[model samples]
Target: MIRCDAHMHTRFSEDSDASVHSMLDAAIERGMEAVCITDHLDKDFPQTPDFPAGAFLFDLGNYFQRLTQLKEEYQKKLEVRIGVEIGLQPHLGEYYKELTEKYPFDFVIGSVHLIHGQDPYYRGFFEGRSDEEAYHEAFEVTIENLKKINSFDSLGHLDYVVRYGTHQAEEYSYRKYADEIDEILKHLISHGKGLEMNMAGMKYGLGFPNPHPDVIRRYRELGGEIVTIGADAHRPEHVAFDFDKAGEILISCGFSYYAEFKGRKPIFKRIVP
Candidate 1:
């Protein structure tokens, strides 16, 4: 089996505490074959009460230098890919593409963590926005960003807004949202991109799997072949959280293969059912 944590963060990311070395050490102990240090790269919304006003943004200069050194040091032990998890915001479109072009990252995971300029990490990001509006904005922002930045390798968590929305899956399944979701999935497939199976939802008490398994199956049905599974793990214990479940979900979704990345290209491995 291939053991990889494609969505890991280090101290370079505002939300994480572990250093790259410490994370690599822990992954090594657990026999991880590959891991990517995907720190957040959100330029706007840099003001967090805990971290200073300018603290939430990524400083590409030092981040690239440090990741370059670590990749060399760990090359003998495991394949290390340098990456970033960019927050897909509409206004910052050009800036993100410029950053990617300037950096030497091997993989890029674009995400929609903020809706209408506020984050779910804060208490009132959704106070004024209706749940429908929030969900709609989430989809709109994702499509807008994808259209602007085709440099990314994959899209993160298709239905992540459900995690914080007022409405749960009580009425809509991923299947029910097929018209919209299929449009997104087809876009990914057409552009030679993929979606990530973010297992973090389960750990966060979202009550369902990430991207919802039903969506995973639909992606398969729509010729969406590439998928990279991640815990979105911020700490050691969560490195492979629900990965077994992730594999099972893929199998049930009719996926005979799962993927890993190196040098910005996906490498698929057959899933033994």
Candidate 2:
């Protein structure tokens, strides 16, 4: 019944301040069966003048230690899966492959948070580009990354750019980038990878899940079955946010099951009414 929130950030992620214990408490309080700690691991993240190089990157040694402790501490109350959200850039495919191969993570979410070394979250990314151009570029880059990388279990937040788009995803839809989106889905299906139903869009004021229901429907139509639901929460309160609505969206998209991962393999759970 979609009991697992598979994508969440903790203090290990530079942008997140939520502690591992706090996130676990929140998930348990919400009656969650499991919550995976998918901290960010953006290799070769572009450096900003204000910060030191690789600020978004975490110390893998410390992260694994914390994860081991958390799993032991929360074993009885909730399931804690070790996961990572690797920022997928065009040039870092081999690096990520080596990193994931070295780590024993339960799942890996390959995300395109950066486009052409610029994060779409800031206004400057859309300063001169048309909404169409921005969105299309994001999709095109994602398709390229997917074609090149075979390391992640699911693609995180397919329409992540929309949250920060100048138009606020007001007119974004599957029709606008259907060809590109379809190609991305086809690659995922062919590689046994999945898509993530990221609920962060609602919190980010997009009023919909990332990739929207139309996109999810198209993925299902293209024989894509594995879809993981995540709050994309960076804080305790945001964990599992808008999940009920997410489930409704999946049901509407004709998805009878949602996926959860273990040892990088998908475990589908039926959606119960």
Candidate 3:
């Protein structure tokens, strides 16, 4: 089993109400070896009716203080790693670099939650364009952001746009976007970055994880080795959700290990057969 759930959010993130203690308790109950609290840090996030200005931002001072205390309290039971999930935009490269360096984060997850200054989560993003076009645009923007951001351990939920796409995964497949996806995989591999296998795709009823099993296989075939398992959970119950299936998917995808991070470096652990 993939014992370390490398991605999760707590009350530190504006979107979640689950406390850090609640999440850690859930991880312990599930018998996980480690969990990373990668709260959101999307600078200059576009404001919407439901999300206002600074909605994706958090107070780093308070976050670090509370987590530092909890990390030690739980050290004997479960490993708690400090992390942040940064929303990648071309303009925020240097900003994120400075923020990452200023803090002592154990891991960082770089994700593209917006495309062209608009969030794909809303139905409006898919309007005036075909689903295929919108999906392609997301991948294109992801490539652009990847080129700009360099202070991340793994790319989170590589096909995140698909979760909100109209018709969702019905019109999505790695083969459909091989040219762009291949370039993305190659870029990550060449940069010593890792891909995240997020289980939240299943929670969203996609029937498969983000990037799909085919993408994972293709990543391996391209000589990419580092992959991390994450539930992308915002609630206690969702912590490590569908992790068993995650292990099966990793094994089937030709991965013998999953990655965990400490002090911004990867530590691979074997997946027992």
Going through the candidates in the order shown, the clash numbers are 0, 0, 0
- Could you tell me the lDDT of residue 149 within candidate 3? 91
Judged by whole-model lDDT over C-alpha atoms, candidate 3 comes out at: 0.93
Clashing pairs in 1: none
lDDT of 2 at 19: 85
- Model 3 lDDT, residue 9, Cα: 95
Better of 1 and 2 by TM-score: 2
- The list of candidate 2 runs beyond 4 A from truth reads 48-51
**Sequence-dependent TM-score of model 2:** 0.97
Model 3 error, position 130 (Å): 1.5
Superposition error at 271 for model 2 (Å): 1.1
lDDT for model 2, please. 0.89
| Rank list by lDDT | 3, 2, 1
1-273 per-residue lDDT for model 2 (tens digits): 568999999998888989889999999887799988899988877666544567788888889888999899889999999999999988887899899999899999999988998888777789889888999999999998987888999999998999888777765889978999999999999999999999998888778899788999999999999999999899999999987777779999999899999999989899875
Over 4 Å off, model 3: none
Please give, for residues 1-273, the per-residue lDDT of candidate 1 as tens digits: 438878888888888988788888877876678888888877776565566665557678888788888889999997788888888877877787788888878789988877767676665766887766666677777777777777678888888888877665544576556667777888999999978988888886875567888888888988989998777777777776766666777888988898877778998988764
Query: Which is superior by lDDT, 2 or 3?
Result: 3
For candidate 3, what is the TM-score?
A: 0.98
Report lDDT (Cα) of residue 258, candidate 2: 95
